[model samples]
Target: MPLGTLDRDPPPFFRQGPSALSKLAVCSALAFFLMVADARFKVMQPLRVVLATVLYPAQWLAMRPVLVFQHASQYFSSLTAAQTAQQEVLRKHSLQSQRANQVEQLSLENERLRKALGLRERLQSPSVAAQVIYDAADPYSRKVIIDKGMADKIALGSPVLDESGVLGQVTRVYPLVSEVTLITDRDHAIPVLNTRTGARGVAFGDVSLHVDAMELRFMAANADVAEGDLLTTSGVDGVYPPGLPVARIEKIERRVDAVFARIYCVPLAMVAGAGHVLVLEPTNAQIPARPAADVPAVVPRRGASR
Candidate 1:
């Protein structure tokens, strides 16, 4: 057949139903209609169920990496938060402990001060309330330093007392502070009277005992001294006032061959731990001055001179 005579369109057996643009418009309209029907009336619900069932395993597999990453992130963040919380708790606990100790110390100090004030009121002699600053630096002697000194009218030989009993005596006085020699000092000696027997003796600080103590020296082996006897200041020593507790007899050693017995005594005052004290004027200050001897006229001698 001649070229001009051939048919311009394809035969019916090989031809499509519509043009591409036409097919695209028709398919888009059908998809829109199906979506609207599914939304409004459940038109494609059965088909959606079948398709979802076929894709369920693949969807689960595809999301595994994302789920793992999210879980790991959450776990690390929680661990960090736990560690931070632990540190905070520790810090707060330590602070609470320190504050508790401070409160306890203050309470103890307050109690001591209150007792000192009460004792001050009961005292018949003039006294000054003073704080014990620290122990004296001398390792060979038992002494303490007080905040009150010459400036506070604290004089040498003044009696120092705590809430319990006589503690020490003012030995050295400075402008702002004073040094008190404890009764337990090795060189210190005091006259004490037994409250039980009314026996008087001299007690010297015992150097043999490891702890602070005194011993009644030069007592007869048969003396009426006993353990647990309370010893008080005799006031005849011209230092501490009479009736002030000095020590308690702890042990008595009587050697058969020895002429005198040794009686060990423990001081009644807080010798090692006193924080507050009262300084009192010496007992001698209160005693009357000794009267001067009257000059007797030598009448016979005068007559001889005339």
Candidate 2:
């Protein structure tokens, strides 16, 4: 009985449906028809849109981590670049500020030097240009030290002048430097003539009374001196050249009890702040020598008395 059941075909309940070749042929034909319909009439367009809309939330959720990582990296990179740019701008600003200060200082020094050269061209006497090194150590006297001395052929008693007018006279000479007593020094005196009235007087430094002034010691109370009157060297002292400006009459006090009028004069030159000066040769050196007179004949004229 077991041999007969094994050889017979199975019942309909256990029979296989379609063969593999037949199912494959049917699925290929259906896919080809669907592709042709979609190409000719867009038959699946609505279905595709519905499917994409349904899957959109799932696609977005899957990409969230990748998008967050890209955004964070970009933010950090931009922040670091901004900080570097700010530091570069600050460094450039500091460098520009230092260059501007150097330019300003150079401009001022150039101006002062130009003015000093101009003064040298206007003088008539043989002169040597010198820079004021410093103020004299003696506080009681108004004096300054020049860079030039005997080595520069600077002679004692030479008149010194600045751009404005007479500044001082060289009193002492050294190897590398010389000392000039300013016109406003207590020990200095100058013979000045009034340009307006041609009045001649001796002007002495008024250090005891004022800082940078001169005094007309013994002028008459009714003298022609007045305020704003210009005074120049009279050339009688044999030190300074004639016609050089010295000072201006600032104040004149006349009193009945006092015999002399107190005249205060302000010097024209920048006595304390002069940076460059001109040292002029003494007037005596420039003056021509006088010729010797011819000796009188040994034999006197017959008409002359014995």
Local distance difference test, per candidate?
0.90, 0.90
Distance (Å) between predicted and true CA of 30, model 2? 32
Q: How does model 2 score by TM-score?
A: 0.64
TM-score of 1: 0.83
lDDT of 1 by residue, 185-218 (tens): 9888888999999989998887687568898998
Q: TM-scores for all candidates?
A: 0.83, 0.64
- Candidate 1 stretches with Cα past 4 Å from truth are 1-17, 288-306
Residue 268 in model 1: lDDT: 90
Error of 2 at 60 (Å): 22
lDDT of candidate 2 over 22-141, digit per residue (tens): 999999999999999999999999999999999999999999999999999999999999999999999998999988998887776567667656866766789998989999999899
Report lDDT (Cα) of residue 277, candidate 2. Answer: 84
For model 1, what is the error of residue 197's alpha carbon versus the real structure, in angstroms, after optimal superposition? Answer: 1.1
